[model samples]
Target: MGVIVDEQVLTCSIPPARFFKAFFVDSNNLFPKILPTVFKSIEYTEGNGGPGSIKLLSFQEGSGADVMKHRIEEMDEANLVYKFKIIEGPKMGVLDFESVSSVNKVEGAADGGCILKSVVTYNTKGDNQNAIQETIKKAKEGFVGFFQATVGHLQSNPDAYN
Candidate 1:
């Protein structure tokens, strides 16, 4: 299988602890509420919300993809790090990818804000370099959208995820 890796970094004004709590720890509840048009729901299909757990994220109608299943590989709450692997998804089938995994880390910045660093690895089935790149582009865009929405929500609702 051909492997492709992509790295991204995003800087936000929110503090690392707050951002991590809202975006990572509480995403299953916050995402659907914030992006109702895009996300239908996020629920655990197996185990609790921890390592070895399986999460199923269902998208709303006309959202291009129906649902995605992810397995939590690691979760370091104290260090604000999370890792997960996409076990099933329409995107994987359409793009001919064998597997997709990501590691997200949030760190405190000098200005009291936070920086989010993400590393995504894609395992492809064949020599579809172009397709893999396109998928990576879309994934980056999606991450930005989600990040912005979460930031907005946390900014507006000060009590959220406290």
Candidate 2:
């Protein structure tokens, strides 16, 4: 299997703690509400909400994916770090990936805002470098779009996640 790693950083005006809380901690609840066009719902299938837990995420029609299963690897609230692995999804099948995992860290920036750093690792089935790169690029763009939408929601609501 071929292993591919990618990193992305996004900066926003929200504080690290609050951003982490909204984006990572309460994402299951907030995402479906805020981005209904993309997410249908996120429900825990096993093990509560901590490490080893499985979450079944259902997406809306035309979103390019129907459902995805994610296993929580780690969630460090105090440190503002989260990690998860995609165990099942149509996107994985289409991309020919054996496994996909991501680690996200939120840190306070000097400007009183926050920076989100994400590292994604993809285990592929064959030696299709171009296909893998394209998949990774699209995934990163989706992540950024989601982050921007969540940030906009939080910025406008102010008291929503607080």
Candidate 3:
């Protein structure tokens, strides 16, 4: 199998604690309410919201309306770090990958905003590596979009999540 790894740092104007609370802590319920167009719902199929938990992310009606199942590999609330792996989903079809894992570390930036360090790894079946890169690109875009929408929602209604 072939492996593809990528690391990216994304900056946002939202504070680290608030962003993590809304995006990671309360996402299971808040995501669908805030961004129903992108996520239909997020449910826990196994465990709770901690490590080893499995979440099924159902997408809204769109081009590829498929549910992606992910298992939480690690979570550190104190450090604002989270890691998970896609155990099942159409995303696995991108490069016939055996597995796709992502690690996200959120830290407070000097500007009072936050910086997200994202690392994505893809384990493919063969030497075909082009699609692996494309998949990572799409994943990064999705993460950015999710954060942007969450920030927008929080901005419009300051007390919505707090």
lDDT (Cα atoms) of all candidates against the true structure: 0.90, 0.90, 0.83
Off by over 4 Å in 3: 93-95, 160-162
TM-score of each: 0.95, 0.94, 0.89
* lDDT score for candidate 1 against the true structure: 0.90
Q: How many pairs in model 1 have backbone atoms within 3 A of each other, for residues 3 or more apart or on separate chains, i.e. clashes?
A: 0
Give Cα distance to truth, residue 42, candidate 3, Å. Answer: 0.5
Candidate 3 accuracy as TM-score: 0.89
Task: Sort all candidates by TM-score, best to worst.
Answer: 1, 2, 3
Q: Where does candidate 2 stray beyond 4 Å? A: 93-95
Per-residue lDDT tens digits of candidate 3, residues 1-162?
877788888887788888788888778998889778888899999988899999999998883647999899987888999899999987476446899899989999999888988898878886656766666677778888888888888778777645
- How far off is residue 96 in model 2, in Å? 1.1
Best by TM-score: 1
- Backbone clash total, candidate 3: 0
